[model samples]
Target: MSSLDKRGLKERLTAGENVLVAEGYLFEFERRGYLKAGAFVPEVVLKHPDLVRSLHEEFVHAGSDVVLAFTYYGHREKMRLIGKEDLLEPLNVGALRIAREVADKTGTLMAGNICNTTIFQRGDKEAVAKTRAMFKEQIEWAVQEGADFIVAETFSELGEAKVALEAIKEYGKGLPAVVTLAPQATDKTYDGVPMGEACRQLEEGGADVVGLNCHRGPKTILPLMTEVRRACKGPIACLPVPYRTFEECATMQSLKDPITGRREFPVDLPAHLCSRTEIGEFARACRAMGVQYAGLCCGNSSHFMRVLAEGYGRSPPSSKYSPDMSQHYVFGSDPSFKKYYQEGLIETVSLNNKV
Candidate 1:
């Protein structure tokens, strides 16, 4: 069995291997009430290092190939929101330390994670710079603390993603950067960029791996991955939010304004999420469609990650045609059934049974 290491993950994929990447600790912690809102990084690492390591170990026990640090939104800016800005360095750096502990234990690759600086100003250079700074600090800490790769995820716009990619290149120094976007269920980003076009832009911006994550469930994102598989040349990842199918919610959020094109709150979301078997099926289908990195987004659980890991790279079960279905043609059960006849069956008139 080949142990996981992020630095060589792309090479392995290029050599025709399907890698299983699992990321889900924050939501798990939150669901358990160990983590309050806006304090995942600090609470998990500083206060409850055992919980962080325990979650990582759960993924390892379940067969995840990567230990993505629960450093999502661990920058100083987000810390300031919850009045924990003073804990920024300890939170960010300490998260990486916790990640390393797990990666070392399980021999999994540690992926440095950063997402959504909350500065999505497209044309404003100052705003973009601030976003870069936010990512830069986290990327620097991850690199210094020895992460194998970087994942910039849940981005809703190409412009903000570009800024993140630039920071990864600047600070990570050749570490593979996987940029994942959160497009609406309509297959376009909330900022109005088509999913395919956004993947292309991230590729051009120097992201080593490009794919979709968060927002939509795997069932709804399947067609979107099919669309992206055409535009993206090499390996791609597809880690969807662990929600039930998007049939309940047409999109991840409410309608956007006609003028500003924004929906502040997500009014529609599934009360229950996908089952372990369904997530496994999702991983299987993504592998068939050429998605190399298969994982879960928010609401991720150890059981679901195990489902994905169990099915990664395995061929889906061959389709079956029901024997009864074939009998329909011969027995004249089908209105247009004319291909064959059943020897013992009688095709008769209604009154006299004359055929």
Candidate 2:
């Protein structure tokens, strides 16, 4: 609609080329915490245009190839929760316009952002259908306004993700679509579906690339990629958040505890922090495992992605060591054979090293 080639973007994405995408808050809510009610008031965006612009520039400078518009909660229903449903199109268009301007100047791609519903309630077919329609309307608008791609990110269940894929096919038609899932504690969807199953569902439902983003940190999701790889045939993109462990949260609570017989006051700690180098390591591992696209999510910035791109071009991990050597070394001894083997051993040191 805006002279952008939707089919071309789909081709590129399906081919497994690298694409950098960025996402952050446009409103002034609790910084780096999970989304809650009253978190996306319109006034926050009006007051923080400069902050949004600065972040866009930061990501572009850090070698990002794409910048996603800050319209994760820009749907009509989510806005109605805050009594601003009328501002849906305006807010969504404004964020895209701003991101497009920055991306145009930096020669980066711009993707339209679509997040999960406000409440993650599963098994509601009607609600899921409604969300799908709203998402289709929003994505069509974004494409008309010139978005290079559409990212349905942080989805919590396979059913919801399936609806999103259907919407993309119906409205987006030919635009590239990337669907990212957020897993619960056991690395399964909130609805108890495995990550591999989710990936398969997304791919079968018409997603160009199936991946994971938000929810957990890099360290936790890195090990799960093997399963994801086995499940889907398409390219994988991993955008992990830098999260604080439960231990760290408990430690902070203890430090803020009061000594007297009074109520426990809430502690206001800074957002969880992560180093670019650590994120780079995660990206490198993904690349080594044949991941074609890589980026950062919550608690991560553009610098994190730049390190990732740099790390992707470096050498891969070595596989010279035998996989069973550790197990052999740990359970190699047989007490019954000690007397029998001692007489046959030419050198006792060689037997010790072998065991």
Candidate 3:
């Protein structure tokens, strides 16, 4: 709409361009106090639409190539959990409209998003039907709202992910779909499918891009991406939460506070957040592995997104604020600084370094 290139998600990927999509909306909105964290229903779309739009604008300016609708957990189940079922349609439509506005204004792709319904049951036929219905309605709204593509993400089970992809293909009516799974502590879907096989299956089922997202952080997720890249033939997406997860705490949900020895997920995870350098490292690894779709999940910020963009060989508008430590009073080497006032600074720093 802003006279930017009209290429869709699939076309850009096909043209060998890496796409950066900024997600982590649930956590970001909660941190900003616009949405409640426990239920994470995303009613902010209906209550404070301007905030959602501003967040989308921020992500675009920080180098996101897509303005993904913040419809995560805006489904009937989540609404019912908070007794806001009446706001379901309005919330979904509102989120889509807000994202559409940002995408049009920023000339970024607008993506309609549907995530795994937590109510999905492996063997319960009724539950499975309900899950499909949830996906169907959201996809319909996304299509009707003129979404450029669909993103069905964070499915913890491979079966549920396939259902989402199927619904996207059926209800999306030709819009490309990006399906990403969130593996649990065992490095596999809750249903026991390995991450790589799961992504491969999604690719076979017609997902334009298939890979992992959320739940895990860079250290834990990057190793899994290796298998995903090897198994999938088409584009792969890697969007991990910006936390410091490792073998001990394989996923953020399992992270423990070093001092308290209690799980610190959802809340109190700031203590373990990954540095911008780590996120940049993740982006470099993603580019090296040929991950066509790269991004951060929960705990992402505009600054982190900028670092990721730089690591991907992109200079987003927000990069203008990237840190320049060379100007630090104690560490600066700029010739214009008066040497008399800072002559003893380097000696003092060296003395302090002595352990």
Candidate 4:
């Protein structure tokens, strides 16, 4: 089986064939030392080939029409963070190869995952420019390596999203591109740019689809989607993070609460985790709100995605209690490094050569 051509992707999106399901932890590589940064070890691809393959098959079995490859942090900068810059291309190519292999086996469409840049700050023109170049180079490589389309996920800043879109336009060679933003609790970016503005900017910058991802949770993103639909005409996608439970928040606060009486203060839990039921509901809402695509983000696993697929045409699930820890990990330390170096494994996995 071959990858979907541009015409095929355009037809799929236009025909309302959206609703992608993410297979979480597929791209998570083991790290070395306890605190030392680790590399994007090849073992993730080797040891988890069946895991990746099964995930693609499962999402397809669950009725999801699209599957995203495991290439979230596959870029050079992100790889450098884990001391695996040399493995960037191999990691990215392996991800696409695995996705394609699974798609060929299951007949599901695949979207190459080209996530946001490592940097989140805005106003750094030089850095942004360099990032755009990197994005362009990466997208070109993905296309050459055989990606059906591209999805740029977890973008918190519109400028970064714009730069990514610009890169796609320059190197996408007309491949379909979907852009997803990570809005703040106020339904805006960290820089205060409204979600609607960000959507519009991405659409203007040549994205086929513009939407939200990795935000607070389904409930918070629901309201934000309304604002985005109002301002943008392109297709939209919503991939919310899992909501936090009350006890989880309390436990966290107990651990981090420095002030003696701070724990006594009312902690209004921010809506975070969207259960399978809620995810399904959100997916339906997205379809109603003119969003052509919907999926899950951080802390969301294949099981959540399965439920999302099952709830494709239903009302959104009720909002559960969640915490407001969205900003806590904005610059948090990397945790996957410990497993990588501990194993001393670095064997590359080859594609099945069916593509």
TM-score quality measure for candidate 4 = 0.72
Candidate 3 residues 1-355, lDDT tens each?
2347888888889999999999998999889888887898898898889888999999998999999999999998999989989989999999999999988888899999999899999898999999999999999999999999999999999989988999998889899999999978897889988999999999999999999999999999999999999999999999999999999888999999888899898889888999988999999999999999999999998999999999999988888888887877655777666375477876777889994
Better structure of 1 and 4 per lDDT: 1
lDDT pick, better of 3 and 4: 3
lDDT for 295 in candidate 3 is 97
How many collisions between residues are there in candidate 2?
0
Q: Which of candidates 2 and 4 reaches a greater TM-score?
A: 2
TM-scores vs. true structure, each candidate: 0.81, 0.74, 0.96, 0.72
Model 3, backbone clash pairs (residues 3+ apart or across chains), number: 0
CA deviation > 4 Å runs, candidate 3: 1-3, 336-355
Superposition TM-score, candidate 1 onto the true structure? 0.81
- At residue 76, what lDDT does model 2 achieve? 79
Best by lDDT: 3
Put down candidate 1 lDDT per residue, 225-318, tens digits, no spaces. 8878888987788988777655545444543444676552232233446776788788778878988888888778776776677677432111
**Top TM-score: which candidate number?**
3
TM-score of model 3 vs. true structure: 0.96
Task: Estimate the lDDT of model 4.
Answer: 0.63
Residue-level lDDT of model 2, residues 278-332, one tens digit each, is: 7667777887787766776754555555676667662111112213333342334
lDDT of 3 at 355: 47
Clashing pairs in 1: none
Instruction: Provide the lowest-lDDT 10-residue window in model 3.
Output: 329-338
